[model samples]
Target: MSDHEVVDEKPEVESTPKTTETATEAPEDTTAATPKPEGNDGGEESGDDMPPLEDIKYDDETDDAVKKKRIVIPEDKPKPKPAEDGWLDVLDNGELRKFVLTPGAVGQPRPERGCIVAIKLVVKLEETQAVVESESHELTDMIVGDSDLFQGLDLIIPLMDQKEVARVVVSSRFAYGKTGIPGAIPPDASLDCELHLLSVQWLDEEFVLPIVDRIRIGNRKKERGNFWFGRQEYSTCIQCYKSAIKLLDATDEELESLDTNELKEHFDQQMKGEKKSPEDEERVKELVDIRGVTYNNLAMAQMKIDDFSGALTSVEAVLVTQPNNVKALFRKGRILAEKGELEDAIKVLKTGLTLEPDNKAIAQELNKYSAKRKKELVTERDLYKRMLQTDKSSPPTTPSKGLWGRSSVTGLGVECNC
Candidate 1:
């Protein structure tokens, strides 16, 4: 306590002068600060108030930074306008519209030029929706690009696929032009058409081969023909079978040149070299058999349509390869019978019965023909006998001149005297 008191007394007296000297220096410092730039003063004031630069974080991944960093942008994006329920602008022009009622089969075949298409359609006025012409229940078949359809339909149907349903609107230019549909569609009237594409089929060989293996394609045609035949659609059945026959190349030249013995020999050689499978031989045989069957089927369909001459030709074609085919022989006989060639019909039926003696159908047909022939012979014999008998019973009519030069009944009573 004694030492602190002595030191405090001496220091306090000296410190008072030092403080006055520092106070005098402060005025000089203030005068120098006043001359400093105003910008520097503001900078210092801001720096003093703000947090340290190192302490504050700056985001490197903000949206603004990312936007500035991007370089590429796409141009001309397509934006489709929403259409009304069941309606769409197919061409993005008001002139052509499509309203889908029922979706079609996926990946179905569309009609192409030279293809045959079948459809059910209904035509109406676009403004009034009044029915004009309709084919609703039955399918109308047309050969694409060749048939006489409405100009609008010709352009539009080829764009449809099988089993598809839609209503299409067409402007006057695409429809029946200035002429319009007389007594039905008015002049320059926009048409609303309901369409159902039932089928698309190509009859051209070159077009079909690329889509399916030749044999399988022919088989499918054969099956379709049989289906139509079962439904008694003879015309359609004949067309289908003809298409199948064409695909098989069952021509006179081809059939004549096809030698199964040669085919078997070649197949045997290939088999010996292990280059051919048993299926190859089987396929060859099957192709030959299919050709014969197709001919027979064609003949049957022809018969149903009363195409007797055509049926005969087809049956003869079958018999060329399979002379003993029961069905071919029966069909040939039936066709001959229809042509009134009874003798030839009997001969054919007898030949068929020789091959298949147990076939009741052939036997029955033969018996019926035999009975008919006997009846005809009997009837003719009776007719001839009756004619002779009648001639014998009836007196001959003649005008005899008497002495008076007048017609007299000479055979009455005076015949004995004469």
Candidate 2:
């Protein structure tokens, strides 16, 4: 039989009327209508080629349970390492760090507020160690607490002394921060700096030293000025003396109220009492003497530079403190003479001579000006005499023009030819 033929062992039963009754009675049974073998024509079961389907059923409990379930995932993160040792937490705020490469002078005066400091600086990237800006040879002057330097530097420089070199690490918050300088530093980049403190000039404390030390320092400067003066370095000498004078706490007006000897006597009297110490008295005397000498040297330098007016001022300062100061008096007289104030010069020289009658220089200056004055007086007298004789020899008269075409002298009544 062909594979398409249906074989039935109950073929005799299907031809019977009972089989027809059974199909009519179960007319709604479609499963019985189509009959086929469980296997295909190839004799392999078709059911084996496909998997069975499992029934899917749902309830409220099942849906609630499904909604309550959560998915958990592991996150990946980097671990932080500990900070390196031997780094100083500068600024105490942890925004800056420092490591000293080399130390500078010990016990030197640190910079104070409003003082100007000179520094050499280098800036680099903290990560790549790449140089960003460097100022090595040319030192930049910054005023403490008042300059436009980086805030980190302004905070750090006050702790350092002259000639100090340090390596500082500034955090991004303290450095240029997120908005860094274009073309110079990167954004949000930490900076590495190499700093050198060169010099400091404390303007606030320039005149606040102890009187003894002030006079001692002034004397030292004056000695240096004398050395320079001997070498004919007039400009340098003037600068040194000026620096010495700037150390004095007294003003020109204050020094003018009392002469040097009177100041010494008053200081001695004050010392005898408990008001001032012996050391203080000595310092005051020295200061007064040194100030007079400084003024004299300054005047001499000014004269050398052809600054006669400046020389006059300096000498007058000296004369104010020491009215009998011979050098100051002589220089003042000379300056006056140079300025064509001969009368004032004569009076100044005469006063100096009264103080030192035996001074040959003063006497000679007085005699010279006196002789010049006498000569001037005689010339004036001769001029007046000539005018008087001419007026006396002629009477008031008017002359008309003669036949010649020449103007005649009227008062003299003299006629001239053409």
Candidate 3:
């Protein structure tokens, strides 16, 4: 009956446990706190949008299975093709390749045989830029590529026309191989060549017959060494002379110091029974003559090798037999010139020229010596003049000032008044 009047009866209902309000302090302003990069936990932060760490799943359960990968990428563009179908290819292949004989190519359907070529070439080692050999020759005979010729040479001869030039690469198989030239090429070395073709001549059957005969005869007479039958038999003489030279080549200074007279005596002993009949005697004389000639030739070889003293010895041996031999006299004079014995050189050269008046070489040498003598005389005269001029020069001297400013008269000298 009094629901509206209950408000006064409830002791204010304990004010419903009034609790005090606590402010959250705006959550400690967490944005101002140490901010972390995105996707970061309190642990290690993999800042990548997708972290590298992932669960690797493999179908193979084996413990030692290796991981495999397959990747694809772009490649470079293709290169241009080389000029591989010309005479260069023929040379490389050691034969002519596919080529059509056309008027446009060779100006004739068929190139003529018996053709000659004038050529120039520079030969160099493949591994270096240094030139090994060079030649410029006006050759009158060159045949093109065929099975009959050296394959490398065959390939190139046909490619060139008159005045055409080319660079050729020669392999070791086509050039000098192992055991190269004594002082020139190395073993198994390839060569680079630049060739200039100056001219060509077509060879006909008649023009080629002589070479064919030579080749056939050379082939047929392989076993027969160089023996001129029915001619003056100089074989014995040639053999002895060659043997002597060979011995000389094998000797050193120790052997050379042996008495030459004793060597000659030994030679005579060896040659005692050589002349058994009149013919034998004649051969022996020829042999001796050839031996003398051989000695002279050896001397010339020695001169070429720059062994001047050895050359003099050889020339002396020759001169013992033929004193008036102009060649020996001229060679001796040249040796003297090399030794710087100018007076002796002039004397010998003059003697040789008198013997051989047509010897232009000796005349030239004499002229050189005369000019040199004149130059030396002029040099000496100039030096003498310089010495006399030096002697005529006067040196400066100080004048005495009346003996320390006091003029005194002495009995030893007379004084002049001032």
Candidate 4:
């Protein structure tokens, strides 16, 4: 159908509903939602755009997942411990410090006493097994449980028996602290030392101190041994010789003060070397002769001091080396005399005189005894002659045989009186 025709026909019928006059107010005032700033997005802002800082609250579900980060420090960290049967890490810094329990308990527990120990040790750096120092000594003693030691050593000694063995790496604080073993180690350094407890006993007041000082001095010498050897080889400068002689002389002086007669003699002989100048062959020979002379003189001193055995040994050595030595032969004779072997003494003296016929000292010694014997013989002979003369001067008087009871005899001719 033609739309216009049907619509006009229907509209002409005036299809309109009854209108009740209902009043409608104007649409309430409407407001539009404002757009947030660039920073605020659903309530989230860029870190830069946010205030300097703000605390953000979190939910329970996320709290457990977000952990509190913690920092672990090595120094404060708990040290790993070991079992009693096994090796224990007593200390741990850059290196590991360990202590081992001995088989038997320490005998005569002496916390207050101290004793010398002979130790065989092998030292190595951390994590690597290369020995930096290895040695054995019949010395080095520590007072047990005393803090005057490396911390590691202090711990180790208390746990050891008299003959126990303890292995350890001494920490920096225990070993050398910040300043390490001067030329051997740097500052804040650690060292590994194996200590074997060879023995223990009560401390000897006189023995401990000198021995400790000796050990420390020996350690210093060990540190300088190679250097000295090299210097001795290539540095024969007069200054070096002077320094050596100074040391030798000082040793001699110390021995002399100690009354160490043998040691003093050794030092003296070593110090009194060949003269500085040898102008001729004779001078050189004289210089060479000094050693023998000093040796003999020392032997004589020993003999004077009643070190008979020592004197005998020294003189014997000299005789083996120099059979024709007058000094040695004379010294032997003197020693034999002191020992009360006058026969042996006379023989040795005679042999020496044969070798040194014109030695006035030897001749004088022999002549002194000879002259005394001759004077005694002369006195005895003169006494006998005097007895004979007395007999001749006064003739014997005999009584007349039968008749005369008594008779008097005169000298020269018998004159009787009855």
Candidate 5:
């Protein structure tokens, strides 16, 4: 419940109560607490497997009463199955379950985190099977990564396809929870919802999409890169990361659209003296975070195949988005050293060390590159000094062989005139 984003505590649709926010990043953390807004870059950890079915239990029939009603299956009759066809048991103890009413597109891919999806939900309180009151226009679309819905939906959406429709029932832990919506949802109320997956767009035609959606898609790509990296497929990992950065890359024109000044100033301020709805600055932070993570992943993949130049470029991009990213600084240092730019490498590693004085990786790399540079400098200096010591007017001379075809030399170890 803490991991997914749920609908605002006070759902705006007033009638349509928000369920848990879904997108599969684990409950997908919940609370419409992100006020109105909203990286898992690693390979996603699968949730605990759905628990096995429970043995039959007599309802209100104690052990003594069971003897009177002995319910037995005939030996010839097939044993009753624990499961019902077409239903997905989502969590332990039957906290959540789903039955698809309509299958999705044939071979349609499941949405990853950060997708912009169109969905329609018909929600009702489980106890009464009465519709939850909300504004009719609520819950038409969602960003899979942000919590503005119920936690159960977070876990359920990934199992759906484009244009798929399903019925999901979730207990209070995933719905309004113990802290129910006042005057609307009661405490400990379970919810029944019919969800329609209208459509999804991840990469193509992403310009007009919400910033949160773009960031989510970028991070999903980074996670894919991590998967490829673990498989030792450096080239594939690099490609995945490249695509991710492209998603995070916001052009100048995009910035103008985000500026409340030139555009949405009226709507944001018109409602009241206090700004109402639509958080733009928070989205910028999300953008920076995704850019940093994606560029860092890209740099690492390039480094794996000794693509030092490319790695340097990628790491620099991370620094631009996140100047203080220690991992980026470390990577940049290494790439510089590989390119024989030790002085620059040392400077970067030093900057990283300042940020994390206890970081062993940065310390060791800094030492190794610094030592190599020092040795090269000393050798060059000695060659230049020896050249300066030689006389410009000095004539060349030939050496004579002494005993075993070795050159005869004086005490100074130079061939002598004798």
Candidate 6:
């Protein structure tokens, strides 16, 4: 779920569903930083328009062909003709087709990969044109490539311009895949969509983006992670969380190192945050919140997939920023317990309990790990001690050679016992 305020729903047409989720940020790459543009909505065209329909063959011989592909508009049905002033784009033998009803605003930025996009859309069955699902203009924020979107939408979104409204038809192979959503959509149904691109957020452009925009982007990613987590997709969930962490990672190492009181206090306040606002301090606080939650969620998801080592790393990231974060400590303790590090598990659980004195889960974990450690210690102690003593007391003996120069079973040897 992302913070995209959902206003309505229909038969599910969009590849990714609308969710109300807060997101997290990733580290910035400024290697090719461009000058801050005048507005957020505008970009160079994707240059991804495939060859004309006549140039493509829908038969099985085609590369990345869709088997038993369904036609978007049957030969007899009326087809949309792009207005001379608008954008018409197609790909993959018509698996993806975009006909822009409204041209993008002049000078508006077109979203690219790694950008966050806000969109409103309704999906329908192509033949019947019956609506399946719709997210209202209130919108949903989708991260371009990372959204776990259907292949067609994934390919089409980056080519869209902010505030541009278009009609999109994605084939079954790129819509819901071969096995479509049960009850909501029939198998092999191409999705007919009316898409609205409301805005875009450039994560890497530092100067052009307002702080609030960045905060929203990070939080949206966090919520997207939650969406995947809810579906029991642990790997995808972890990826969403890590993406947020990267977005929220401190961009200026030197400034963070100054150790100024105001800066230190602000960082501290992020964990114990103040009221939300749009100012830098408030935005920073929001980012920290998103980062902590993202890491915590990442650790939990990793644990689900039995990636205890990775889970440990994720939780430790939270612990680095918020040492007393009980959730991180709890997750770390669980990861350690999974790794059979009962001692470390017990220690972390104990620390967490001290922080949240009334926490019963931590208390239980502490008791369980402590008992396990005690059991292990008691079982191994005397046995290892006797073996050590015997080894120390006994002198080593060399094997005597047999007739064929091989070591013999009756060779001279030493035996030791308690």
lDDT of each: 0.65, 0.66, 0.48, 0.48, 0.67, 0.66
lDDT of 3 by residue, 320-366 (tens): 65677776787788888888787888998899899889888889888
Clashing pairs in 3: 113-202, 113-203, 114-202, 114-203, 115-201, 115-202, 115-203, 116-201
Error of 4 at 220 (Å): 6.9
lDDT of 4: 0.48
Q: How close is candidate 4 to the true structure, as a TM-score?
A: 0.28
Off by over 4 Å in 5: 1-206, 251-279, 390-393, 396-418
Per-residue CA lDDT of model 5 for 1-418, tens digit only, reads: 1111111121032643434433222453444323221122343432334221222234455543232322333255352223668677766468888888998895979886767678888888988988886611234446564443556887788778889999989898877567676677789999988988898868455334455656776676666566556646566567667766766776554344455423254323322344433455555556766777777777767766788888888878777647888888888888888888889889999999999999987898899988899999999999988887785555554566776677765545665544
Which is the winner by lDDT between candidate 4 and candidate 6?
6
- Name model 3 segments beyond 4 Å from true: 1-243, 246-285, 392-418
In candidate 6, how many clashes are counted?
37
Model 2 CA deviation exceeding 4 Å by range: 1-161, 165-201, 205-207, 249-275, 390-418
lDDT of 1 by residue, 1-418 (tens): 1121111112123631222222112222232233344555433222223223222333454643232322233355464433867566655667667776777876866788767677888878989999875322344445555323444666667666578898989888766556565677788889888988888877745342321244675666676666556646567667777867766653332233345323333334423544434455455556657767877888877877789999999989878777887888987888998998888899999999998889888899899888888888899999999999998999896667766576666666663222
Comparison by lDDT, 2 against 5, better one? 5
Q: Could you estimate the TM-score for every candidate?
A: 0.46, 0.46, 0.32, 0.28, 0.44, 0.58
TM-score order, best first, reads 6, 1, 2, 5, 3, 4
Please count the clashing residue pairs in each candidate, in the order shown. Answer: 0, 0, 8, 0, 26, 37
Considering every candidate listed, which one attains the maximal TM-score? 6
Clashes of 1: 0
TM-score of model 3 relative to the true fold?
0.32
Quality of model 5 by C-alpha lDDT: 0.67
True lDDT of residue 345, candidate 3: 85
Deviation of model 6 at 74, angstroms: 32
Flag regions of model 1 displaced more than 4 Å.
1-157, 160-212, 251-257, 260-285, 394-399, 402-418
lDDT of 2 by residue, 339-403 (tens): 88888999999999998899888899899988887888899999999999999998676555766
